[model samples]
Target chain A: MDDRRVAVVVEDDEDIRELMVALLGQSGFEVHAAANGTDGVDAVKENDPVLVTVDLGLPDIDGYEVTRRVRRFTDAYVVMLTARNEEIDTLMGLDAGADDYLTKPFRPRELRARVEAMLRRPRVAQAPVGTQAPIPTSVPAVPEHGQGDTAGQAAGPTSAAAGSAAAAPSGPAGRTDGSSADARLVLNGLVLYPHVHHVEAEGRDVTLTPTEFVLLETLLRSGRVVRSKAELTRILRGDEPDAGTFVSESDERTVEVHVGNMRRKLGDDPRRPRWIETVRGIGYRAAGAAETSG
Target chain B: MTTAPVIDTDALGRLGEQLGDPEVLCGFIRRYEKMLGQRVERLHHALNTQDHDDWMDAVLSLKTSSAMAGAAALSQLAAELQDYLAKRPPDPVRWPVTDCLESVMAKLRHLARETARQLRLFLNRLSASPQLA
Candidate 1:
């Protein structure tokens, strides 16, 4: 168990599910594949894998619910996959106990890097003498490993078998304020920094205009649902609170034109988008969620 | 026959403080010249070929490039040019396009030269504005 790292991939699509498993397996992870949310929950409960990736568009239970459920039972990293590449969905995913999210049709390497970054985080060891953890004092205390009967404890052969059991009392041991300094978006090998406004693709920095940088950040933050052009313009300009919605109609059109230009600079394809994708009648979203661990 | 440049470095440096990276001023100078040159070259080709789509593309690129580089005056000028072209009836044969092109090109060159001079005084030497040259 300690010799290998295990990652659970819960996706309904046969091809995507198989692809994820193969990708993770090739990247030095023992892959556990689940077809739906229910099976995924069961697999995590049994496997105690170090990381789990859940797709939002599950056939049975929604992916958000799966994240919530799994979060309650284990400390394994939960990365949600959503098709609605909107800003709200990205925030909501974080609120639902997801460590990170990536939109569908993502790059295999990005997904693999996210999993590795999550695993590399030091799980908070049971409150050491000097460690400052807020574990509730009221819960009946169990030994160092944890309460054996606690639902959080999984019984399966651990992914990295020897002693890779996740640390107790999950809740992003090393993260703070829902943001990591090193947190960044990597799509199709393009690295975008949220705070720095820097983009690097194929190991070279791609300079973006101020507006382009703003647009990219907006897409990354909201890559789970379709963001209307109006909403985007308003966000960019910070228009009046109640000044009327029609003010941004022209700005809305500009958003599309600017995005078209941005796509050209990023070398993204609209016909078969491998990065920023267009939603027929709605708006644009970052299609790739495969982020590298910065 | 030089006219007073429209870009005021004092105002730009103040804006840069709010925008972070004082070097964005220099960035504006470099990018505006590079993009303006490319757009002018492209527009010349588009005009020769009578390609409305190519013309529009050139104008759009110029507009966005200026806006991003913090060349507010130049961007406004480009926007006006774009609006005029977009709103005016197409007369491919009688287009007074050369006049508009020369006017903007001259303005941009003056701005670029002025910006370069200001960068030398303020950024490199960290000095106040040079007395009216």
Candidate 2:
């Protein structure tokens, strides 16, 4: 009954997985480590973690498939880990139901930061407004004597927090400034807010997970213009403008999946889109017809 | 890298005069219907739910869509809405919903009525045009 959020890190790579577990653990999160997709999925069911970071290149089942499978039974925040910086992989992860994506060789501090950021979003009460609380699941508390953490917990010792603060600007993550303000997008009976990350359709507030809202808004803002896989990855990942992580430009089907999700929510037909039009061989576009269909 | 058609004034104006006609206005009408109708619907939904987050999202969308369709009044209104909503802890009083939303919808409907009704007049008279060529 600790109620502290738990995190499950799934990866075949012992070193990376341990690194993530330690990183999360230091932040006072209960960490579960899974070496493969099947184990990872089972761990999620058993632990019901609030967050799960998965590596895309798993030994048995690929990370993308694992993410898709996880979506069926859980709504945990999923951050996909990719070794190849391939834009397609990032899109695939998002489409497969991942809430976020991180390329490999990422800073451990960045991972901890993402967990905290995702946690900070005010969760809309999942249970209907004021019935009986659902059965409470057991949340494991970190043993006070445990030494399995790194130096970057958000509210840990001052020096450790300082190190992360210093590393943040240089890390391959995007930070929003108040100056740029919130972003807005209108497309085919849909409205998207990039700043707060919200969406609405046809005068009815549509519930979109954070990832879905971001993906849809990004596409709408780009107009009917097709965004390259790499471009969309940058936008979604919010990589530092000058960060030098190697990014693969090929493969954009992940975007297609997000587009497909958006289309479904907007009541557009996938095979024949009236909202997000498919651009063969390049990317997707928001056709004018698609926007006004409703 | 294949280049997209230049949407600049040089390109649009040239294309406008060359296409001569109905296609230009017809295209504008069709595009406006989608863009404006969607924007209004989104705003209406955002406002009805009192979902401040969704309201900002819809307003931001209209900001861009209005500019694209040459609905100066609506574009400016959308921009105003976006700016107001973008401010953290947004103030609901500042939204220009009554005039801007109604005007945008009306103008869009008017534009959609005919294939070509003073296309230049519509584009030129608007105040919130996007960066034109």
**Prediction RMSDs, each to the true structure:** 21.5, 25.9
CAPRI grade, predicted model 2: incorrect
* Candidate 1 residue-wise lDDT, A1-294, digit = tens: 144566888986554566567667667778898988999989887887767899876768878888767754455667888654455666566555565577653544557655654554333222222223332332111212232211132212232211332322222211222233334567777776543334556655454433455567667656555666765554444332133546344445556766775676677889988778888777887785545354
- Stretches of model 2 off by over 4 angstroms after superposition: A128-210, A213-261, A264-294, B1-133
All candidates' chain B TM-scores are 0.56, 0.48
Instruction: State the RMSD for candidate 1.
Output: 21.5
In CAPRI terms, where does candidate 1 land? incorrect
Per-model CA lDDT versus the true structure? 0.55, 0.52
Provide the TM-score of chain A alone for each candidate, in the order shown: 0.47, 0.53
**What TM-score does candidate 1 get on C-alpha atoms?**
0.35
